[model samples]
Target: MLFTSSSSEKEILSIISKQLLLGSTDARHPFRFVNLCTLDGNQPDSRYVVLREFKEDLALFFYTDSRSEKVAQINKNPNAALLFYHPIERCQVKIGGKAQIITNTELIKEHWNNVQTEAKKGYQSVLAPKTAVSQPEEGWVQELKYQSKNFSIIKVRAKQIECLQLDDEGHLRIGFNKKQEVWQSTWLVP
Candidate 1:
């Protein structure tokens, strides 16, 4: 593929949109999982999270337990990062942004409604996440009701996006940052 400055920018955006859309349909898709990074004091914490939703040119959505340490970290410091890699395509994307927890909102409720009962059971645990347990089964109770309070969604408002595409012919890198409420993109050496 030819990589002119203009064409590369367009191709980068196209790839991002395509991969995000693919995540919604293909469970095995590379974009289905993202490495989410949060700060715990001066230390960095990272975990693999499912990519739940992608809003074009806006933000990414993921769900987590409100009692989880990541949620608490986000509440304390909203700054976060997400990294996604499509090995088959040899494309990688890194996003830096601010994260906000959504709970008790219509959006959260709607997300919960869409989840299956079996998955919803995850939020119904009586004990908080990361709690010590003598046995694995003792961690969760056979609850009669789902704990809506524990179900939380995260919205990561992207401020910058860095994408790299590696191909047999050549490699391309592009960076996009929000400036004056508009996205300004530039080509980076890969």
Candidate 2:
């Protein structure tokens, strides 16, 4: 287990922050892909999103097409949840936050420039995501470009974070909440 009963809340938070930061840069990290849940009307919509960046202020960013359904959902309801789990470590982290579409032109350009050439096709598709097409290839662009207007970033500012670590002895859980720019943590029953 990464944490134990004797672990302090600060230590656990540090570990989680470190892991998340590492996940942002390491493609193979378990936290690299997260389950992002957003409200679609009264129902919950969940999908896997790559962890493109993690800020020290508890903000996480991911790339998506501007015309994707998720962008529409976030526009209607900004509240969202993110789930990260490592099967081998038997640890899970759940984050509740508010999501916003990043509109800063420079920020979007920076991220778009970093996207690999081969992966750029996803954003350069001729048709918007989820568009109906008779053939699968019809949805894709016939000619690839270095960039597309559909490239966008979604930022999630975490309000509450809960971590659970499974151990043979017993499970350990902790909760962290941010208010007024300060963070408060507490041990939770598991």
Each candidate's lDDT (Cα)?
0.84, 0.91
TM per prediction: 0.91, 0.96
Tens-digit per-residue lDDT, 1-190, candidate 1: 3233457576667668778767755779988999999999979999999988888766788989888999999999999999988887778889999999976588888999988889998888888989999999988675648757789999998899888878776788889998877888988898
Steric clashes per prediction: 0, 0
Q: Give the TM-score of candidate 2.
A: 0.96
Model 2, 1-190: lDDT tens digits are 6678888888888888998998899999999999999999999999999999999998999999999999999999999999999887899999999999999999998888899988887788778889899988788653465565889999999999999999888888899999898989988898
- Compare the candidates by TM-score and give the number of the best one: 2
Once model 1 is optimally superposed onto the true structure by TM-score, how far is the C-alpha of residue 108 displaced, in angstroms?
Answer: 1.2
How many steric clashes does model 2 contain? Answer: 0
Displacement of the residue 54 alpha carbon in candidate 2, Å: 0.8
Weakest ten-residue segment in model 2 by summed lDDT: 139-148
Candidate 2 off by > 4 Å: none
